[model samples]
Target: MSPHDLGRIYRSEIEEQPAALERLLEHDAEIASIAAALQSRGPRLIRMVGHGSSDNAASYGVYAFGLLPHWTAMRDSITLTVHYDSPLDLSNSVAIGLSQSGRTPDVVEYLVRARRSGAFTIAITNDPASDLASAAEATIPLEAGSEQAVAATKTYTNTLAALVLLAAHLAGEGARIADGVRRAAEQMAESIPAFARDAEALALPFSYTGRMFVIGRGVEFATAREIALKLLETCRVAAEPLTATDLAHGPVAALDPLFPVWAIASPDATLPAVQEAAQRIRETGATVVASGTAAGAVQGVQYTLPVPAPDEPLLSPLLSVVPGQLFAGALARVRGLDPDAPHGLSKVTLAL
Candidate 1:
């Protein structure tokens, strides 16, 4: 099937991300102020909590904090913090909660617990007035508007953009973020058709491939997880996301020609490690394809998908995740499934 023939609301949302990201970057001033306030308090640690797509976005935050500020940051489990009442001394920390709808019950509870424990709580969501926003000390609106499709596209990318803005501010690299955001947006706009064409071609031949492993390191690790989730929800593929380091230790043995491996290579310090991992996977005879922006990021791969390799590598997620979203939507359509609505998923997942 051609890209045009597989039109769906999910595809529309995937195309909508460039504009939504432009809007998200407009809130730089607000993010700057929040960063200033947080810096003044000198947070020594960051604890982020979310579910599903939100969790994937928050994983980028964890990586950002470590890379940019060299601080200790973690993505905490909401179930343990909420249901089991896990104890944490968050006095010198900032707790962040992310949810697209801003109403995930356990995520809200995570923020509440953090706040009660004297941590600074921040909420990131598309809804400024959501319960998650209300539960935190401050909020960062996703500015992605209403994502009508059950599969998140704009919201997920916008969430990453918002987090990058916040990370830039905290790292005192605020001046560079706007330029990076603009370039990423432009590149994303230019690359959309290329991604669509690649998606159509790949899906036509490989849509029925039952399972795959996605691997990346550092910032791109979140991209790996997000893409795997998209494949699972949309194409009904059993996609497992793994770290490049961990996979080499053991999981690499399970990979071969029949089991596909998607390696995300970003133009950053971690590129060498990821490239090595992808090269190793390729030798295993698995159908290994790569998605990245840098000229040599995907070197030696049999198939490649291009995205903006942004000057600010932290913001690459805004561009990298787009091609993955398109692939998932196109694969769903080619496989005789609806990309907009999956079989057992909904827009907002409410769990106690």
Candidate 2:
């Protein structure tokens, strides 16, 4: 509880996740209004755009938008939209811009272009007056307050929840979505202490690991990517994010019995495929650590690091990442690195 703790800022933000999610739920009406407006537009796809943690948040939206009563979604090419200014037809599309500070020039520029191209643009941000919010037609506030950590924690989770709610509204699953959010908040609060123990133990193994792969499938794929990025930024680990299919395709060759491989196996449609991939990776003699509620179900993995189960399958990416965030912060502290102030980085960067 000392302020002098190395990763205190990052830890505090991670610990505030439940309250941040609660703030999001408080804005349900606003989110619903925007979702209704978007539905009226009859958009066929959601084009998500952001950079850094925000970009990873967009990946969650991709999964959210694809949930049953399915809708297509894709990441907008920031280079094409911002730098090259390529003319794109977006009349039948919805574009969502995500930013913590809401000041990233490239993200703002892309939102501007998407709006001009006839897309119903929306910005999810912590700062209401931020440039990205101004550029979009509507805004979803993250309500994460001020995050002093160099690495994003609260904002990422809050933004993910907002995207999920938006998706649920679009799919006409209002009541279920509200219940799911409440359950998710409770789980997040309870998981903190349990996962803290797991993270503390896992840090010892990761401290000695030179490189690793973080794998997930479906919505959890984006969860893996965010975890890998945190490990890389905070712990200085050469962590690569890959999907189960990608590992099976060719990357499987790199793992050895001594090699470190982390798998996120949640309870979802992709579980069988991801577990199958985890079993195969374990056969390669690599040290496989399976994470998620179904960690015990993934036979052959050397470690089963269980996290709190998600309330809804579509919310897997948001809940499954809790343990990974704890692991990254703890692992960085174990490695004598300052997780809150990682080198060669800032809280925000202007891609343009």
Candidate 3:
């Protein structure tokens, strides 16, 4: 592929993220209505299901719903519902399914079962008319439009925005949540163009890298996972996602000289621990690429790719993942791969 043509589609979608988020927030009134219904039910638990990038969104949602609404949340085991067909009692709980296409069979089936078991089911998807949406009582459309790239970029961020809006409404802090979401989108609008150029330059040095680790803590851990998946799919890099706290347990032993580590951290409680791990990993002669607002604060990282983010840590993931998406596309282009079409993958997976 020509240098000018490489990753064109994927990069374009990454740049569309800000508009996608703005569109999602335009449906704030609908999200507020859903929250009112949820609040009225006084649900005690939230069970979320998704596959791939949607699952990573669910991982982030687990924390957001828990922290904001003060409800117990779990990344539900889809296997139990899809494979084992185990009877589940979801009374007084909310079940949410996240999917870009909203056509994942497993997700649709799980929501169908949840609704049957007395749970109020919701679908967060780009397609409100998709099967997953039909299986649910309510749908929060991502409004991300059609993503040409096989790997998700705008849809993932929009999913996060939708979740944040819903969680904010449920928590009863309408103004604050709206401000946070709006600010985060504005930051992305201001920074993404520069971030894309920077990511392309950054990818040059690591184009030959075979494997690496992407680390984060708390809600940002989901950012790590999403980044790793992007690199794996777009650049064909074996990027492993790990929590910074878990690095000391066993994963740190894998580090070696020239090994690349992407440490994603925000200015939150998890910052100190993530910074500590980055410094420790730096001692191994591994190159650390620090990302997010805490990038400058972290010591010993070989490269810093700081991103503009919100004051609230939960909202940071929406911004933090931008660098990852850019890096993935840039690296793919540098490595002579077309990020728009990776081998053996489609835009949507109809998981059984």
Top candidate, metric TM-score: 3
lDDT of each: 0.84, 0.86, 0.89
Residue 103, candidate 2: Cα error in Å is 0.6
lDDT of 2 by residue, 1-352 (tens): 3434979889988999988898888888898899899889999988998877788888778878887448998887989877887898999999999989999888888889889999999999999899989998999999988899998988999988888888888888866886798788888898898888989898887687878999988888888889999999998889999998889898899888656888998777888988888878878888888997678778877777887666677776667888899899999888788998999998878758
> Which candidate leads the pack in lDDT?
3
Q: How many backbone clashes does candidate 1 have?
A: 3
TM-score per candidate: 0.95, 0.96, 0.98
lDDT tens digits by residue: candidate 1, 121-202:
9999999999999999899999998898888888898888877788878989777887788788888888899888987788
**Candidate 3, 207-312: lDDT as tens digits:** 8999999999888988999999999999999999999988889888889976789999888889998989998898788999999877899986778998876866
The stretch of ten residues in a row with the least summed lDDT in candidate 1 is 1-10
Error of 1 at 193 (Å): 1.2
- Model 1 residue 300 CA deviation (Å) reads 3.8
Candidate 3, backbone clash total: 0
TM for candidate 3 is 0.98
Give the clashing pairs for model 1.
256-286, 257-285, 257-286
